[model samples]
Target: MKVAVDTEKCCGAGTCVMLAPDVFDQGEDDGIVVLLEEHPGEELHTTVREAANVCPAGAISLS
Candidate 1:
């Protein structure tokens, strides 16, 4: 699975980071979304999807 985050669309909600810290993080200064892993292991796919689902800004994308 592949994970991608559009920082420009991020609203600093932190939902993605809370759901999948292993694959996602937030910028300390702006609180924007950060992609920690562009391609996380399959084991993390579910959580990553959930994170994407819960993202209010629709900044997380999986392919």
Candidate 2:
């Protein structure tokens, strides 16, 4: 699975980070969504999808 995040659209809710720490993170300075893995493993697809779905700002995208 491939993941992407739009920092400009992020609201810093940290839902993505909570759901998929291996694939997402939050910048300490601005609290923006950080894409830790652009291409996560199959094992992480489900959680990644959940993170994307729950992103309040719609900053997360998957392909």
Candidate 3:
């Protein structure tokens, strides 16, 4: 699956990073969601989806 994050909409909640650190991270200054890996493996799909679901700002997306 392909993962994407809208940094502009992120609120520095860090939920995505907390749920899937391997594929998501927080910016050093703003703590906004950062995409660490765009195309993650199948094993990580669940975690990535969960991250998107829990994101308070709805910044995470999967395609």
Supply the TM-score for candidate 1. 0.96
Task: Kindly report which residue stretches of model 2 are placed more than 4 angstroms away from their true locations once superposed.
Answer: none
Provide the lDDT at 47 for model 1: 92
lDDT of 2 at 7: 91
lDDT of 3 by residue, 1-63 (tens): 888888889999887778888998888987877788999989999988998898888888889
Span of 10 residues, lowest total lDDT, candidate 3: 25-34
Query: Which of candidates 1 and 3 reaches a greater lDDT?
Result: 1
What are the runs in model 3 whose C-alpha is more than 4 Å off?
Answer: none
What is candidate 3's CA lDDT for residue 7? 83
Off by over 4 Å in 1: none
lDDT of 3 at 14: 86
Rank by lDDT, descending? 1, 2, 3
Tens-digit per-residue lDDT, 1-63, candidate 2:
778889999999999988999988899999998888999999999889999998999999998
TM-score, every prediction: 0.96, 0.96, 0.94
Model 2 residue 46 lDDT score: 89
Worst 10 residues of 2 by lDDT: 1-10
Question: Which candidate wins on lDDT?
Answer: 1
